[model samples]
Target: MNGCRAKGSWVADEKDTVHYSGAAGGWGSVRGMTEVLARERPTPAALDTLRRQNKPGGFMCVSCAWGKPKHPHPFEFCENGAKATLWEMTSRRCTPEFFAQHTVTELRDWKDYDLEHQGRLTHPMRYDRATDKYVPCAWDEAFAAIGTELKRLDPKSTVFYASGRASLETSYLYALFARMYGHNNLPDSSNMCHETTSVALKKAIGSPVGTCVLEDLEKCDAIFFFGHNTGSNAPRLLHPLQEAVKRGVQIVTFNPIRETGLERFKNPQSPVEMLTGKETEISSLYLQVKAGGDIAAIMGMIKHVLSTEERRWREDKRHVLDVDFLAQHTTGFETVKAHAEQLSWEEIERESGLARADLEKAADVYIAAERTIFMYGMGLTQHVHGSDNLTTLVDLALLKGSIGREGAGISPIRGHSNVQGQRTVGISEKPELVPLDRMAEQFAFDPPRDTGLNTVDACEKIISGEVKAFIGLGGNFVRAIPEQVKMEQAWQSMRLTVQIATKLNRSHLINGEVAYLLPCLGRSERDMQVTGAQAVTMEDSLSCIHGSQGNGHPASDHLKSEVAIVCGMAKATLPPNPKARWDDWTADYGLIRDLIEESYPEMFADFNARVFTPGGFYKGNAARERIWKTESGKAEFTVPTSLSALGLGDKEGRWRLMTLRSNDQFNTTIYGYSDRLRGIEGTRDIVLMHPDDIAAAGLAEGQVVSLASDADDGEHRQVDGLTVTPYLLPRGCIGAYYPETNPLVPLWYHDEASKTPASKGVPVRIVT
Candidate 1:
């Protein structure tokens, strides 16, 4: 397009930056991992913790939710997982003395990376308004103050938020405590990430989770990946993909950016591959679609498949469509087929950024494969029509009878270790999803049946001064959300805010009128309750539930496990209810598991026993067994009429921006400034764009620019001082780091059905 320099010299002006053109996960991953471990200078205890991570009786990795194999490798941890472990198990500590040195106002200005790099927090601290600093506070006093405030405010105005890092046990207890306290406002990380997947899948297949296990990837003849960056988000999944490639499985990927992780991979664990520097090519066909163009791409495939079916039938009286499977196991095929028939090739090509020939090639691959697996991530879900995007994926699968087979199903690659488990154990805003009758009978209290607030709704209430308090079990809630400026301002209006965390974050600096920072033990630390050393359970992306018990020493003597922290809050807030013995749960988490079983018997039956089994047990899915749990007793198709999922027409001087994570980052937790795969270093405040787009906008490379959201909302959402870097992308698409670019997305710009923030695709204009 413009300024055609050598591929490696795009950033010649910046000394610290260089584009990396090597395959993902070889010596580069090794160097990156060494740097990560060297930051903390691995202690003996930390080394031991690494050895036991992802093991049967050891703690789960506090990272992505990629499934574990039946017999995991000794070093089952990925580079990101190592960063997570060492980041938590670091010897450096954020003590009371550290907080005393900096006031809340001063700490608010610190970068998120710097705040977390200070290491694990070691004491419970409360904000001192008069002094503008945090001082040490006893755990009992903090809980008592929180309880008193909760009792004072209306339950409807309070929210209990959970991050995806919590274990299933902690999530269960947290949900129970919130319900016990007479409210169901349980907004969690899922609301921002995969709530669309849950909403769409349940309606289409009667299951909210994936229908495949780790073995499915091995047996599948083909796999289609959409909008997921495996190298940075879930590096562990690369090994299996490499194996699938070796075994002659066809893999196709559709993403706006050509991620290095998905292009080629060199297995770090393979001695021969690493020594010889040989890399395995990942995707057989990589389609660089425009941002938010997945729906159009899928529609094009459907059109090709249908056209082939009609041509074959006319030529030789042969059938190409899975007619029997559609009649027997699915509904709404006629509607989907009719919709595909009317669509013109010109519209599909224009919207999808793919030519008709490329779509036919992809469709041919889909037809040739006996079994195929469909996997997608946040890119497809973080849009105004996110649910529509997922349901459309299901329609294509059903067209080929891809679901309810051994190696075929729709998979939404989830974030965090236990995000899905948290929802499974009852962290939900919808009251109907909970077992209200069983909970009432078991706990001896009338449960609240009113619908609760999601993250976006809670932010709205906080801004309007309607939400009085916020209790975050884990996560940097305010920092990771939209409308960063407004959310930070609204956070001050809360009467009380409690953050149960292991490390310091930006959310802690954005204090409420009365804020308490409670220090909880990290997943890598030993959690010895009254019973003995305790183990918790986590559910992975494959719907497998497994046990995880910490092996290392606690970071601080004053720290407590998450279950204990939940118990302390519950006991202080509620009067003595004989049936709900909160104290017993702290001593023995098995008691909490029993209660979980009582609440959701169908899913969690024999919870305590099955969870400890080697490799864990598969939580069965009815849809996998050809049993439709949908309202019509069959899989249903969804046809979205809009070409642009966001309902926006083409506009000149506009770019659809998708926020992404760097190789050195996980979610909002920034580890370093360098995005090793993208060849970025020294800074994160840069925007990646196609060279043609930059030249078309009359912007020169390395020029400073400002981006303003193109929303009709009156709010001027903009992020300035971003350097323009040329990259390979579609004509009207750009990429920037998340939480930095989150402001450009309006808080109201989200999926109507699921309320998930459209973080992946925000329309913006560049200002020189």
Candidate 2:
């Protein structure tokens, strides 16, 4: 953090400030598409890659999971989706010659944007210790080397990490392999993003998956978006919100920043909007809540609701609450009700950074609405009390009888397109191993029942030299985690590290004693195999299990699908097992789906036939059916009234920084230096701050400043050359971008319950 460097050109002046006019996706979106079209210059065959995006017989975009519309438009994809597709299907190739010229040390200095832009990796490569470079190797050789390391180390200490971008088939096979190899150490992207939502929602609604589908947006009387930026991260979602606005659905938002997408959106799909430049107003009410102030806002809303219910109950003999629904389907409501009533208005206002009147206004809308959909994103989940915040939101949803009904439930707008799918198909570190008995019966072995490490725990063990080897299915592992340098150094402690990815990321540049880059097929590229060109399955944000078939040919001849790569690793690593036919699964992906059906028979019955159906089938949620399946045979409420919003104490000037993504990028991949939505151009070094705070801190607009995190854990945590820009933000609140601000977050900073890093809100002090 101390020696951090800003890469690339940065053009910002003192007069620079947030200047997005109240509209999104007109010419800006058009410009985004053309920029990639001109730069990538994909062949006519590759251009067809986007034809199948978000539609039946198409591959899922490796971007955000805003859920998919049942009736996908002709241009099913969005701006960010276009970028991801073009980036993946780019003509640029990273040949063996490229690796021959660049050493690990030299490539390490290149920025993330430059590294990935070099293009698809065309061959399997292994690290050469002598030359400190990667040399081309055969797939078998790579798998054998990883197998040798696995055999040399304890399976308990070896962890397998999977990204959400990986197909469901790959995740299923990975879990099967991990169990076959006799290790429960499986951690994936879920631990970093929406683990809190999954864990908390299950307790409240008796389901781990979201209860609503894309169709729910059409019917919901009121839609509340908490801690999400739909316009940038999940662009396709804006279209749905725009439609909802047209239908007069009351949309309320709670976020730290006034995202342009939440303000207004013009659907590029609409000819009238595109031609006339007409925009749809999105949020009916937008509350700029503090980063970790979600729980307070939720509590205040509940407090108001409870009072209204009491008054209504007195006015009429009939109950104001949904007496039948609550009494039959839920437990511990009175306890939550009591706690919310006791919450002082002053405390809620101070913690949430919201006026009580505004909170009351939102509450009034909630009380008036008969059906509501509560949706949230990383803004609420990536906090010290992330799980608690989610739980509190659930409490409000339940109090208003918002859950366990059509068009009324708690949902999370997943950032990664297939991230939630990874979890559904069994990529979990702290897994219940729910079907362990069934798995043992079917796979002919005793699967591990104990829960294993998550993202935070796995990294900690790696830092402590406990984890011997690590394999990532597909993700920028070390780059996305907290304490960037410390975690990067942790890679060197490993005996083996394997990155199964399409492109060369920063993780590939950083090396372990021995490393392997098993180049895999991109999502947009067809995974041709023995059983014809295979189509993989993916679950969208709303738990719709759909088939994603690549409409285009392979990016590189040397590339293997994630299914093939995983099968190869498993065959090399595991002892002979006749029951587990790794070869057959690799040859035919439908066989993988057959095995998945065997694992989750009820949810994925006739997996092959059903997944191919038009919009795919929704995995049945008991909550949506009003059937509770919790410990009490009812959806039990767990009260969360904790005030622990951040790691650093509630002190003035100790600004709460919320890490966000620019429109130019998705996750760790940097697409460009500009965020056109926020009017930021040619620079990512600018930190958005309140105009008053800039003067109070003795700092001027566009003045470059250093940020030192308050987590004083002996190691210095600071981001360099961040130019301060005045903006409309709450006092003691600021905004920073991901990967750049990743170093400022301490390793220990995460929710104790969910273990998700407090990336959305970290306490830091500006060192001018």
Candidate 3:
């Protein structure tokens, strides 16, 4: 914490101030985007890239998984999208010469921001143990070395990790190559983020992906925002929400802290709004629930609805519930009704930190709206009972029959651009979730049927020396995961690590004994194959599959496409198989698309032709069609017995810590030091606490403090040197930016079902 400026260290800045009262988007957003463009990519070419983003035949935005409109505006990109583009298309390069100047040990002390700020990686490099640096290496040589190491170790001992940045074509090849190598150890960013959504939704509604399309939001009478901050995560979505508010749609928000984006937003894309300073107020009702209290809060809403329906039924036999939809399309209504009736108001109030009257008000809105969309983010999913929290949300939706139709369905707001697509194309660890038989028939090889490890499991195995090899598609793997201290050290002990990325990150610096750093084309860069320029497809959160063709110049001549990199690794590792046409597939992406159609005929039929269709085509969800694919063949109501949102009970002097992203950042990638929406600038190492909590702890504004986890686990986890800033939130709930505060969350403290790290509800105490 002292010497190294890595994850744990924090720097105090006099310029940092808290004045958190402003609309999310407007001139401020324009200014932020302009600043990034000026610093990173201030050129006509960069502006052109922005114009084409999210447009037909243009590159997809590498930001969030929000879908594009049928007829998109000329400038569909948002501030976050602009930052992601410049971050990828930066002129700065991390060459072998630069790597030679700095040793791994020395580079470890540098901050995560500094490491990535070095810019796009320029060439293939291999770790040199003798020199303690990364030396230039040929792509062929690096792949051969990785293949030889893979041949030496068991396939189960290796982990094939993918970030959500990879396109559908690249992800398919990556998944194919791993199964050919004899294992399904395919762990990706989803395991850390939305695995709870996948697990819960699949059981409750029969499909993992969200049922609603972009148009559904427009058609909805009410939009419920549960633990989701749309501004920082998906800025372009603000335009839609702004329009919804104008249309008189009831926007109900339930979160521990008041996110400005959820409260009000001025459409940055709208010139009149920006010029006239007309901000559209969002969220007709804002309920600030305690951290990890989403389950209790949602259940409270259910309780109110159930009580009202019962009273109305007794009065005149009038039904508040959708009796027909419940009887025909779903089952287990009695279980949900009984569970709600059993819950006490005192217990719900204590757990949720919400009054009964407010819950009733929210329920009334839900009851009045003909169509409502239930949307949630990591806040509800990253808990001990994360799956239960989601299922409980599903129960509420089912109570009012707010699903299986247009404008009414569950939406899990995913982070990365193609995160949902990766899982759809079989980048999953679960053997049952993937089509092993079809894959075996297509490849003419026996596929591995054993369940693979997830992010948490993979890290534990890496620490225990069970996993020897690590292959990342595109992400800061070591830096993004929890238990930073242990995982970073354990990552170095692997036999071989191959990172296929667009830029330099802390993960590349924390090299394995025999590590190969292979630079690949970013989403904004041209990915030319043997068949001219290639167009890849990505599935957004709405399950729309669209074509994305990069139009910019490559960062370096040595850079290859992610598809090519995966094919190269496959050729180098797998034994000669007549059925596997890696070279042909790499040459013509249409062949890959054809094979994808052959593998998943139901979803990817006519993939090559339909992908080129304007605005892409929907991958059709069964749940959306009211066709349940679950074991029961019907939507099931799951009753979560536990009232504790996070199993961690209330402890004296301990605060429920929820990690979040700043307006300037997305996931683990830090764009700049300014969080303009929050009125903070210069640093991300500050902690957000309620004014009452700050005074109760005897802490003054800007006072430096440390946070230690209150887990019963043997390890003492803490983050030091955090500046205290007073923000309006629930009294016992505090907030800090993630990856910086990841150390406080233990790897084992995750959702019981999904194994997703409980990042939103780590019980910690502030220590001076």
Per-candidate local distance difference test? 0.87, 0.83, 0.87
Reference-based TM-score, model 1:
0.97
lDDT-wise, the better of 2 and 3 is 3
* Runs with alpha carbons beyond 4 Å of true place in candidate 2: 1-16, 316-319
What is the C-alpha lDDT profile of model 2 across 1-768, one tens digit per residue? 211222233334313345565377887888877887777766565567777787876777778776766677998888889988888888889889999999989998888989988888999999998998889999889889888888888888888998888888998889889977877788888888888877777766668777887778888899999998888988888877888888889999998898889998988888898899888889999999987888889889988988888888888865556778778777899998878878899999988999999999999889988899998888988888888888788778777577877778888888777788778777776557357788888888888777788888899999999998889988999899999988887789788889998888998877778899999988787778887888888888888887888866677788998998999998998888888898899899888889889989988998988876777788788888878767788777667748546666667558888888988898998887768777677777878898778888899877899888877567788899898877777788899889889999898888867888889888888888
TM-score of every prediction relative to native: 0.97, 0.96, 0.97
Error of 2 at 429 (Å): 2.0
Off by over 4 Å in 1: 1-18
lDDT of 3 by residue, 1-768 (tens): 221112212224212225455688888888888888777753345778888999887878999999988799879888899999888888888888899899988998888778888888999998899989899999889889888999999999999999998999999999999999989899999999999999989999999988899999889999999988888898888888988988999999998877879988988777898889889899999999988888888999999888888899999998888989999989888988888888999999988999989999999999888899998899889999999999999999988788888889999999999999999998999989888898898889999999998999999999999999999999998888989999888888999998988777788888788999999988888778887988899999999998998888998899988988999899999999999898998888899899889889999888988885666799899999999998899999999868776968887887899998988888888888887776677888888888777888898887889999888777988899898987777888898988899988898999999999999999898999
How large an RMSD does model 2 have?
Answer: 3.3
Find the number of clashing residue pairs for candidate 1. 0
Total backbone collisions for each predicted model: 0, 0, 0
The 10-residue segment with the lowest total lDDT in model 2: 1-10
